[model samples]
Target: MVSAQPHRVGAELWGQLEPNAGLIILEGSSRKYPYIDAEALVWGGAGATQLGSSDNDATFEALVMTIKVRDPRGVSDTRLGRFMLSTGAVRAMHIDGGHLMLRARSKTHFEVFGGVPVDGNIEGRKYDWMVGGRVSQGLGNKGMIGASYYNRFNAGQRSAAEAGGAAALRGASWVDPSAKISWELVNPGLAEVLGTISAQTASRVIRGELYVTKRSPTRMLQSTSLFTVLGDPGTLAAGGNLRWRAAPRLDLWVNGALQDAQDDFGWSGYLRGVLRLDDDGKGSILGELRRQQVATSSWTGLRLASVIPLYEDHDTTVGLMPEFEIIFPDHPEPNQGNVWPWGRLALRWQPTKSWAVAAAVEASANQIERYDVRALARVSYQGQWPKK
Candidate 1:
């Protein structure tokens, strides 16, 4: 006979010592959905970074992938991995909780924009996924926050590794997207000392879903020397928007942001108006302009773009757009040197509502200078799901 105590927490079973009898099996919920999403882009053209030439065409290709799944309540949700680049290289994979989560940065391409302080991804491109809870009860809205990381398991190009060695990797280069990472910080000297804090506001009216957010990165450092002075980028933004239903599928929105300098005390203001031509669906003509005003420089340029919809009615879609990007980095100086002109054509496809694949081809030339073309493709994905 085996003896056991119902109050005890541990016990042996069968041939082993019998233990506690008070143990109870707990039932947990299961996930409701398993979702997979992917995005990819291939580009070919010319640029300063490709083919080792600054005056000729550069050709390149890229891709992106994002995957997500739902889990039960109380337990951690599955992670959503994202990779965005001119190539289909994995860059970031993160999970969401609330204020707590993990983010692992890849080593291939590093990007630094504002003066925001950041630590290098010590865990490299990969790390454990972590996230806090959602933001709903308080704001009457829904969103998630999480983190993730990834690591390199091997070194050769994906195709090359399949063929087995350095030579194969080299041979695959023509088709394989170049991999890289970017990290940078902006410091605006002298500008921070003389600037004033900004206060801006905006409103928009339309139909559909309206995602209005204040204080976004674009509203901050678009054209400032802040990356040169303050070390921390300045961006203050506020806006309200709505999607309307009418002819040309019109959408009216107004936005403004305060762009402060880095070191000295100076501030630039930005305001934008957007009009969507074919509001009945997803095609339209878009225009944008940013007013650049620093202590010594002040100028503005406008852009016109034609938007085409792809894969309508699906959680994923595609679009093709072409636009002109003109920047007068320095103002007043008689608009001197090159009145540079450039045009870009882009193809963007999304496999999931939260992910997109983008490819861009650009060509530029100063009437008298040599012309060049550049190409790049990227995969970008983002998602926010309410915990269940």
Candidate 2:
């Protein structure tokens, strides 16, 4: 396992049970404060068996858990867990309590999956299972083609608690389904192109999309997508990005996107440049300029940010980062004709191999109409044995 911090907890066990079979087990957990006032925990375990010559011909089971806790103003939490089991013949089963999924794959590149509702949500929303399948065919030196489909029914109930009265409760149901087809072509050093067409039904409404992407050896990428909703508006969008290595210590990137809809058309573009003063991004400076327009709102902005290491050791490091942004709105009347500005300062410290802490403060103003301030602090710890 690999980690950004020096401390972790992980274990593995392996043994041969027979001439043609073997068993393996693994467990690991890690905690980190990747951002101010936010603590995240990631842990998981897996077990597997080998029964044939090919490594793919094995049985395996795995489970993962993730939790995040944050307090920028008040405390908030998010948690999720997943469990899966699979056999050697490409058959698998997975459950997350709220839903269960089954999958099967064949050597001919055909795959299928089905979902079943195992439990309802806190608000009593019940899903009525889903079935999906995909088939792909390789075109040898050309590329590949694939098609997929999925269908499901969703149901929900309005509880008395939310409706403010026991007699006000109600239930609703909808049938939803989607289908897609895609093709790809690859030309080494020249370009790789992919195109897809998709359609979906939601709450009796239908929507369709056509998307395409192209990547070339010139450190550039481009994409375009067109979307339409039956009896509604349509949209066409395009985007492109370019990156330049420049030097070992400096890098530059530019990105732009344009969108056109029945009622509005707008474009957004940005350029960013970064200078690294250290090999590990411990000390770096970045500058960016962005321009955007959409409907009646538009803005041109510039941002600068930097990170500096205050102290460092084999197992610990202390750092600081400061950032600032300036904005000018094209519609001065809506923005009060005043340039908006925002700034943030952060401090982070890792005093031990298994512990880290961070704190940050932010201040912003909206054209003299309002001013806001916020602050946050977080701490995390991790430990491991039998270090590898």
Q: Which one wins on TM-score?
A: 2
Determine which window of 10 residues in candidate 2 has minimal summed lDDT: 160-169
Native-referenced Cα lDDT, model 1 = 0.35
The per-model lDDT (C-alpha) reads 0.35, 0.48
lDDT accuracy of residue 122 in candidate 1: 33
Q: Write the per-residue lDDT of candidate 1 for residues 1-388, one digit (tens) a residue.
A: 2222121111111110011111111112222332222233223334434223244544342222223333222222232223321111122222221121122232112211111101112333122222112111111122112111222121111110000001101112122111121112121121111111122223222322212122223222322223433344543222222333333455444433333344334334443444564536467776666665655656666667788876666576778988886655553234243456679898887787656667777876643344666565555444333421
The best candidate in terms of lDDT: 2
* Model 1: per-residue Cα lDDT at residue 368: 39
Q: Quote each prediction's TM-score.
A: 0.38, 0.52
Name the regions of candidate 1 deviating beyond 4 angstroms.
Answer: 1-70, 78-248, 262-279, 295-297, 308-320, 331-336, 346-361, 366-370, 375-388
